[model samples]
Target: MPTFNQAYWEERYKNDQAQWDTGTVTPPIKEYIDQLSDKTKRILVPGAGNGHEFEYLVTQDFKNAVMLDIAKEPLANVAKRLPELDAARLIHADFFEHNATYDLIIEQTFFCALSPELRDAYMTKAHSLLAPGGKIAGLLFDFPLTEQGPPFGGSREEYIALFGNLFKITMLHRAYNSIKPRAERELFFIFEKK
Candidate 1:
């Protein structure tokens, strides 16, 4: 397996191989934000390639939203397009190494991009980053797990067992509004930290 280090990701952006980017926020995440009454919640969007979801958050008047990416390219692209975003909010660092607290954390395509062994650490970091009763919500790929992916996959049963220890699975089901290409392959989840 190739080491999915910073260089690998930077190369993916530099070479324009980011097939996972949908160019806009997915419908489920958009709908989730649309219903949220709090425009001031502190939000973090980790591994935010091109930052479309975070962009959507800002457009909805969410004041404290931020997006972090391990690679510079996507963050730079976001910066170029959205100059209103605070420079400090567009972080370029390893996700595990990030240290902060938030009311909500967004999971776009980040989880599946990680090395499978880091799943436990991802959960721990996410939990640590959340304030009391805060939530981590968004899409998770639902498919067979195999060695052939940066967009690696996992089943719903596995997600429940993996996240149940530290988070209450408030909602975990197939996203009804997933883009056509991702239709039955994604699960929309709301996992509140316990």
Candidate 2:
């Protein structure tokens, strides 16, 4: 496997090789956001490449939306795309190093992009980032875990085993609204901090 680090992602963005980026927010996530009644919730989207979700949140009148990425390129792209958003909200730092807490964290392609070895760390970091009663909600790939991807795949059983101890598994099931390419191959989940 390649490093899957800052440099690797930066290079991917520079070369326009970010195949994981869907030019718009995924349908499941959009539907999830559409039901949110609290527009004031402190929300964070880590590894938010291109920040389509961030843009959507802003459009929906969410006040405390934050977008974080390890690489500068994507964050810069977000800044360019949404120049009116506060610059401070576009964070360029390692996700584990980020210190603030949030009421809701949005996870899309972020988790699967990490090396499988970092799974535990990702869970731990996410747990620490949430305020009391906070939740991490989004899609996780539902395919096999293999040695061949930044878009690494995982199963529902594996997710339950990994996240069950630290979070309340509010929902974990096959996503009914995943985009065509990911149809039936992703799990829509809502894991609330315990």
The candidate 2 region of ten consecutive residues with least summed lDDT is: 77-86
The list of candidate 1 runs beyond 4 A from truth reads none
Cα RMSD for predicted model 1 = 0.7
Task: Compose the digit string of candidate 1's lDDT tens values, residues 1-194.
Answer: 99998899999999999999999999999999998998889999999999999999978889899999989999999999888778988999998999999999999999999978999999999999999999999999999987889899999999999999999999999999999999999999999999
Residue-by-residue lDDT tens digits, candidate 2, 64-94: 9999999999999988888788899999999
Worst 10-residue lDDT window, candidate 1: 80-89
TM-score of each: 0.98, 0.98
State the number of backbone clashes in model 1: 0
